[model samples]
Target: MSRRWLLCLALLPCAAQDVIQDWIREIEQSGGGQVLIARAGYDAEANEIRLAPGTTRPELFAEYLHQLAFVRELMAAQALTVSRQTPEEGPLHLILINTARIAGRRDVEEAVIGHELGHAWLRTLGYPAVAAGNSVANCLAIHATDAVQHILIRKELRRRGIDAETPWIATLNDALDQWKVRPLPAALTPCERIQTASQWVDVRLGLDEARWPRITGYEAQLKTRYPDIEQAVSGLAAYLAGQDVAEKEVNRRALLEAVRRLRALAPPTTPLKTNQ
Candidate 1:
């Protein structure tokens, strides 16, 4: 098959968001309706954090809210807030992104949002749990783990017969490679930068299976639901191991849409907004 064909094949999994949504709908349909997601409430006193017109994608917006809710739950578990401002205390904060500028599609954006939300959730869970020995080392472990998970997702795609030439997979790997060699800036907080670097290495080497049992548990859960995950990941892992570009610009436009979905959740803001 042509490289372009492989790219399309890879993205086919992401295109099945509708099927995933259907599964969610089925749960709701079956009265297994549990509201794990929390919505941000309106705050009259706070500034209305309006997003620009570029930030448009209702499904992604809804998904972002769901992710925020998930993170909020984690925060509640640790008795903290993801931001300094509570849902009711702050403005109607909306994440805005230049949908045109990012590198993937709407589904890609969805994946990115999910990952970013995971970070927010982690912060809410309280890093203090790991703050010992070397705080910088701990932070590095967390951030690096997140980045590694992103690459892992790309790997999963390949196992599903999705080609590496696809824009999302290609860019995902490119990002991972660039991150591996990039040096930490001296001005950055030691722990945070360390965590960021750790994440880069994690993406390059894979998540540390020995340290985090929770990670293993989640992986098992995802794989249980999606059996093809192993195949997808294995394929990409093999490609990355060999430095092979298996796919090429199959759906550049669609890929860009995916990135937009991500930005809607975690808009690249100034000063790199950390979990407040």
Candidate 2:
């Protein structure tokens, strides 16, 4: 067995302890740590968020949820909101980020970055240049793109000896680690189950097979459904996916441009407000 896995196994129990409490304490205090969790319109009383009962690790899951909300609010404050109701020209708002389960160990950062990329990638798929945020198809696409992002940057991840999966995995060994634990209707329908399982399998297989790039197979799937988009956006996704920490890198430029385009395309936010 790999030393990394062994170390992780040994650490899981400690991880399950007092996660939500720690997060509450951190965000409640003022300083960089509080900055980590706070944002406009975020009601700490209501929005600090909690892991549902089914999550494999409530502490880790809750901590990552805090980061997810932080990132979403950060982007909005910066005017990079990812959508409009339709492609026909109107107020472009933020993309609706539907949460999906990662059945593997990729970090929350990768998941966040990959999801935004998913929104951009879908635009090219002609999945309706607008209205994606609200669509059922968008549900699976979110996980699909995150899976693609991991395939792209995982080499850099491993080269640094960083575990490609989230470190929190070290803490949770059971169903609590699985996912949302859902909504008022927690049960997924038959189709939702298939979509969920398909994505989970995609990332798990992609992570296990070191030599195979999952994007190749994913591209074939995309090509089948949206041939035109497959030709246009795959190059862009590849360009952004290949980024490293090097200065003035081409992939970095591509990444910036992709984000810039999304931001530029967004509609001006209507000045609005209220307590949640």
Best by TM-score: 2
Question: What lDDT score is found at residue 108 in candidate 1?
Answer: 49
Q: How many residue pairs clash in each candidate?
A: 25, 9
lDDT of 1 at 50: 25
The C-alpha local distance difference test score for the whole of candidate 1 amounts to: 0.33
Please provide, for model 2 over 1-276, each residue's C-alpha lDDT reduced to its tens digit, 9 standing for 90 to 100: 532233234212334323322322332342212111111223357854443333332342233345553344332221112433334433222322222323233344233333333333333322222112322333222323333333443443444333434432322222222322421133444324323333333334344334434434443443454443333344434444454423324333433343332222222233111101
| TM accuracy, model 1 | 0.30
lDDT of each: 0.33, 0.33
Model 1 agreement with the true structure over 9-125: per-residue lDDT tens digits:
432254644433343334334443311212232234663222223233334344433444333322222111122223443312222222232333645434433333333333333
Worst 10 residues of 2 by lDDT: 30-39
Q: After superposition, how far is residue 32 of candidate 1 from its true place, in Å?
A: 9.4
CA lDDT, candidate 2, residue 255:
34
